[model samples]
Target: MQLTGMFVHPLKSTRGIAFERAFAGKLGLLHDREWLLVTPDGDQITARSHPQLVRVRVELLPGGILLHYEGKPPIFAMTTVFTRPHRAQVWKDVFQAWHGDQRLDAWFAAILGQECRLLWLGAQSGRALKGGGEKMSFADGYPFLLVNQASLDDLNSQLAQPVTLRHFRPNLVVNGDYPWMEDEWQVIRIGEVEFDVMKPCARCVLTTVNPDSGEKNPDGEPLRTLVRTRRLEEGVCFGINLKARNEGMLQLGAPLEILEQRYSF
Candidate 1:
């Protein structure tokens, strides 16, 4: 198999940026979901609860980030050094976030009718995964999420409407494979990088949203079909969450070889 597409979500639940090659970090891709939007009490807010956040567009430039949203003029923040820690929350998890000195919290609160804050994941943070396995980073659960192109094609074929990969929010999308073939893959080697397939990425309501518009469609279309065809004890099966076995750079179009294929449902 081979990597067909790569994406990085700089801020969780806002928007993501596509890339050709990306540095593999403990948290899947570098700068992916490193930042999050939260409330004053550190509760994480996402498009699952707030669909309007889909309108918030983020672009990572050489210096800093450019944020564009409805009713607000484009805001630019420099990539200068961060001093004070930005206070924020992610769901029930509370952590210190690094943020630019812009009035982002106030602006977001005013627009959303609640107290909201923008938080950036700092390189110095010691957040790690809690499972009894190799250390991982802040990625909701696993380090990396990968999907096969053929699986998407199969799902698209079943739907009356077309859905893009963005609906699934995978870190890596690989081609040259059949639907659910990745489930049997144990270890995947891409170029010099090696990753162990840890677990299956369960489906969620986020899969129903159009990543571009942040609009939530009827859930029954895809999720219902998946439940009937690919449902496990937890949820519908789609991709595999991977943990880095050996660290190395991942370039675009790199050949992927499955070292082990002993996975079972």
Candidate 2:
């Protein structure tokens, strides 16, 4: 197997940026999910609910991020050193996270036509993994999400319209020989980083939204087909959640070494 793609979503739910090389840290990729849009009460505003969010594109800048939307001027939100802790929530995991620039918040509020604030997870995340010890950013659950290209191809064969890897929002995409081969992988190494395959990623309606147009597929395609084909004990799964065992640089075309695999059923 080989590593084929690397991606990072600086702002949760917005368009993601593809990378040829990225640093694998404890909290997944370097700038992935560091920024998020939330309500005044701290609930996450994702593309799952607000499809318009997918229209916003984010560029990771040196000290901050650049936001781009159609017909609007690109906005730059600088990251300031935050000392105060503000309460925020991602799913059911409520924790103290830092708020971003007020100007950025206003920009988002006007775009979404709803009351919301932009938050930064700080230089280091305060949210701990469910079991404890390791910390994660604003990702739904695990630190990293891995998708197999072959698996997607298999799903496309059943679909009327094909979707790219962006729809699922994975940090890493590997080229494997067979479909769903990742299901049996327990441990794998990419470049200098080794990751523990944690669990099958339970997909959601967000996959039904077009990453480019931000419109829902009226047919409810891949997700609908996955329900019939890929449903496991844990929801409809299209990818695997991963936790980095060690930190290092991950480059495209890196060889994927399987250190361990699950026993055959």
lDDT of 1 by residue, 148-218 (tens): 99988988898889788887878888995678788788888988889988778888777777777777786
Q: Would you list the C-alpha lDDT of every candidate in the order shown? A: 0.74, 0.90
- The parts of candidate 1 lying over 4 Å away from their true place are 78-82, 85-94, 99-102, 132-138
Among the numbered candidates, top TM-score falls to 2
Clashing residue pairs, backbone N/CA/C < 3 A, model 2? none
* CA error at residue 175 for candidate 1, angstroms: 0.8
TM-score of 2: 0.97
Model 1 error, position 102 (Å):
5.4
Superposition error at 4 for model 1 (Å)? 0.5
User: TM-score for all predictions?
Assistant: 0.89, 0.97
